[model samples]
Target: MRSFVVSVVSISLVASAVFAHSGVKNEDVMKRMKQMSEMASNMKVLGAMMKQQQPFDLPLAKAAISKIGELSAETGKSFATKAEDPKSEAKPIIWDEFDEFTKLADALTKDALQLQSSLKGPEDLRNVMATLGGACKQCHSKYRE
Candidate 1:
């Protein structure tokens, strides 16, 4: 399980590197990528706090989770259109499997909200990381390049 999480993070880094050089020029895809990037940034904050790499900040983590949920709600709107630029990490499968893609986004929103409410501190937050990470990996593996 731990190895799997590392692999997911590895793939994300590799994909980001590949896209950075891919010369993506589409504004729409860029918007979608930005949304995902923001979520990733928030996740890092939460991970740092939960893992004890940083001091726990409950209000800050909750705020980040709320932002993640907000971005998640806009996910379907962002990716529903087809405008793949060279720099896009999104796959064609997103449009082909639109329903499933939206479902995954909805699931993430739900997870974020639930985690926000249920997590009281670092220990509770740590326990929810697997479920949170798994939700992200599911969409990423299927929809992202």
Candidate 2:
């Protein structure tokens, strides 16, 4: 009876260690990625509204831009905290090329801040949209699958 209990505890310890080393949960990473995707979708809609030169919905546009900034910050945190999680779509190159990733993230934050600041009118918003799009493209091309 004593030997059986010891064997069970030893197996449990090894299993826990293996699981811990493998990767993050797929669902958890997907949830984080989905939040980012939703933020991007909202930004796209705001851009289209600005391009159309419709009555600038200041509140809505501001909210969307704010969400983008929030999500970008969250993404930066996740990338830093869960650096080893293979389940995240974030490329391993993100860690391997840390300087480049940090530069792009900084650019993204800057573009988002600019978008928030320049939402004074439709034309200004459109111009900021272009910069925001460039930031997204830059990061996606380098760090995403």
In candidate 1, which residue ranges exceed 4 Å CA deviation? 1-22
TM-score, one value per model:
0.82, 0.68
Please provide, for model 1 over 14-127, each residue's C-alpha lDDT reduced to its tens digit, 9 standing for 90 to 100.
578456645657889878877887788678878877777667888988988888899999999998788888777788988988999999999999988988898787788766
Q: Estimate the overall C-alpha local distance difference test score of candidate 2.
A: 0.68
Clashes of each: 1, 0
The candidate maximizing TM-score is 1
Model 2 misplaced regions, further than 4 Å: 1-25, 53-55, 81-88
TM-score, structure 2 vs. true:
0.68
